[model samples]
Target chain A: MIILNILFAIAWMALNNAYTPVDFVAGLLFGFLVIIVSRRVLTREPLSLQSWFTFSARRNYPLLVWRWAAFIVFGFWSIVKANIVMARIVLSPQLRLQPGIIAIPLDITSEIGITILSNLITLTPGTVALDVSSDRKTLYLHAMDARDPDALRRETKQEFERRVMELLP
Target chain B: MSLLEIVTLALTALGVLFIFLSSVGLIRLPDVYTRVHASGKSATLGVVGVLLGVAVYYVDLRVALEMLALIVFFFITAPVAAHMLDRAAYLTGVKPVAGTAPDDLEGAYNRETRSLR
Candidate 1:
């Protein structure tokens, strides 16, 4: 497992085009830093092989390839949609915005799953993830044009949560 | 100015303007909750604009790829941090904007008849 982690770290650095001698030193330093930090930060439970595999495989091979393909298509579409929405808001005469925060219930229990969902929401233009409940059961999102909060919840649940569940395990 | 120079300058100016607005909004917004909105959203867009301008100026694969990575990392982390801050505020009973309408969370909680049914 440690070897796998090191190899993954090396691959990540290489992918970032950080392969010089100095970069190699920096990567080693970063690996050491991650270990030190994880020792302190990861106290809830020791990660098992299953968990590690789950985390690694999501990046390598998703369980639901079709869902991932859809996500890639949808993700690009969302980016275009976001740019349009942002332009409209910035250029609008009245700037008639109704911003509100809504709480979304999360079904996925894995930390990685939740983290991915939060990042996905943040990357999208119209919404931002405001918080996660301490119990990790609910996520708070602030939407720029929250016409109906229920619709926002359903949108999140359907668009992100369902795909995440399919991808994670 | 040449077209390339003009484009570069325009993008750089807009990027800097966004950064400035984000900083000002961070200060001018009413509360921490609102400030998060200003800083997180505006700054991400601001940095992306700056990076895009840099990519255009450099026009090299390595620099452009690095800029892309930076944008992706920024987009991923900014909202997660904001979410943490907002949740902390809410749990501490920070006052929300007054006279807001349609709190379904409250309605649902009130409608529940049994705690363990």
Candidate 2:
């Protein structure tokens, strides 16, 4: 493979009628592509390095980038909405509130995913991620006003958790 | 003024408003945990808004990237800080206000064993 790459690079430089460093680097890149393609064609099998170096994380980089943009936009709008809600709660003349910790079960099992979910929860209005259960099956969150626990749980799962799962997983 | 200036001003105002509201929540809320909610969430958003406003006003790629980096850093750090603060407050026996229901972790701690039950 090394010899093939070098030979292809030399051929590329000859064809281009240039032997400069930049042309050599470009030839090196072109050689890599030629080797990859010829290997696939000659062996009738996928490249060996493909299996080893294929990162699932990188497979959808463009998609992830777009989704990340969406997440940021959504997060910004949610922040605005949360701010308004919090302001209402704080500025209310009655001081009517129903604050408590609600245990939300986990669907995102990865450590990074859970961390993100918790961070997002804490940053959103009305909710603070207090602690993760010892078993890691549950996330305990404190809400400033969870008048209807079931609805809150549903909203969390549908909105925050779902989007986070899509993003991380 | 131009539309961009108007939008930047609006964003700045909103950001400052959220920051101010955070202080209000800090003063009005009942306990340490709730106060963490106010400071953690509102303050982070407020700073983001303010940074975004500035970013828009400048309209430069470098400025936008810097603002984005700042926002991400704030997002990651704020919650961890809030969690640590709440955890410390809880371990130190800071109780919630009167009639704050659903104390599920009430018996989850085993002080003698020095571990969570």
Q: Number of the top candidate by lDDT? A: 2
| Count of clashing pairs, candidate 1 | 2
What tens-digit string does per-residue lDDT give for candidate 2 at B8-66? 99989988988999999999988887888888888887898899999999988779889
Q: Taking the tens digit of each residue's C-alpha lDDT, what string does model 2 give over A84-114?
A: 7888887888787788877788888889989
Provide the lowest-lDDT 10-residue window in model 1 chain A: A56-65
DockQ of 1: 0.22
lDDT values, one for every candidate: 0.65, 0.79
Q: Among these predicted structures, which one has the highest TM-score?
A: 2
Q: Which residues of candidate 2, in runs, are more than 4 Å off?
A: A1-66, B1-5, B110-117
Which 10-residue span in candidate 2 chain B carries the lowest summed lDDT?
B108-117
lDDT for each residue of candidate 1 in A1-169, tens digit (9 for 90 to 100) = 2453466568668877877655655665566556544532343335564554444443433234446778767765664455445544554556455667677888989998898888777656667686665678877676766778888889888987887777774
- Residue B59's lDDT within candidate 2 is 87
